[model samples]
Target: MMVLPFLVAGWIFLVGVYGMVTSRNAIHAIGCLAVAQSSTYVLLLTVGYRRAATAPYFTDTPLRTRVVDPVVQALALTDVVVGATVTASLLALALQVRKRHGTVDPDALTGLRG
Candidate 1:
């Protein structure tokens, strides 16, 4: 079960990277980048997983009881927010590039010497 998450995360990340590398459109590349960034969430969740571990809350459990790492969970949540923000900003930039250059293709945009 533990290995499954890692494998899935690796696959997702690799696929996203491949898409980004092969994509011809700027918007598609940004979407691929967002997909790659999402893999971090799965990885972080897997890291926080604990066999037979209870929640981080102290209620109904002793202070020393085994519990999943709250820090990892917090980091994962923060990463989600950061990823969304980055994706939105990148997409907005791509939109502006399309409007200014009249094309979203990276190859076509290369001629923008000015």
Candidate 2:
């Protein structure tokens, strides 16, 4: 199997994490979180990829033909959906934070009240 895709995914994940760690604003952190979540799509696709493999549709292929894994593809799709949902939720929460606190800076919101 090729190692490049895995390396690329890892690099992307690290970049996102670094961005999240250094981000000051809540919106920026949410964007970084989404970027981090996106790396899973690349990882899943890389894991499911097969050289010279056809699509997962088995309607016309022979019994022994190589086909990419459908499960991983499904998982990647699910990851995308979940990522979008999480991002949206975080964005909404950030909006609420800005509305209530008048700022989205992480350092400025240290005294959050319940």
Candidate 3:
């Protein structure tokens, strides 16, 4: 069970990288980048998981307090937010390119030559 998430994340990361390398459109490339980032987020979140860990919260139970690792959870949450913001920014840029140039294909986006 613990390994399932890792496997899925790794597969997604590989697929993302492959897509980035093979994609011809700028929008597709950005989507691939997002996929890669999402995979890493999943991996980090899985790292915080334990076989039988309790939720990280204020509780009187010493075992519960000891079970959860706050650091990993915090880092994962921060990364998730940052990744989302970056993905949105990249997608916006792609949209702007399409609007201004009328094409999202990198090869077709040749700028005016002097």
The Cα error of candidate 3 at residue 76, in Å, is: 1.4
Cα lDDT of model 1 by residue, 58-81, tens digit: 777887789999999999999999
Among all windows of ten consecutive residues in candidate 1, which has the lowest summed lDDT? 105-114
In the range 1-114, model 3's lDDT, one tens digit per residue, is 668999999999999999999999887898898888889778887887776777777656674354667788888889889988998898898898889999888878888333
Instruction: Tell me the TM-score of each prediction against the true structure.
Output: 0.91, 0.96, 0.82
Which residue pairs in model 3 clash with each other? Answer: none
- What are the per-residue Cα lDDT tens digits for candidate 2 across 1-114? 799999999998999999999999999999998998898999999999999999999888999999999999999999999999999999999999999889999889967845
Model 2, position 50, has a per-residue lDDT of: 94
Candidate 2 TM-score versus the reference: 0.96
Give Cα-based local distance difference scores for all models.
0.93, 0.93, 0.84
- Name the runs in model 2 displaced over 4 angstroms: none
Candidate 3 error regions (>4 Å): 1-4, 63-65, 112-114
Candidate 1 residue runs with Cα over 4 Å from true position: none
Q: Which residue pairs in candidate 1 collide? A: none
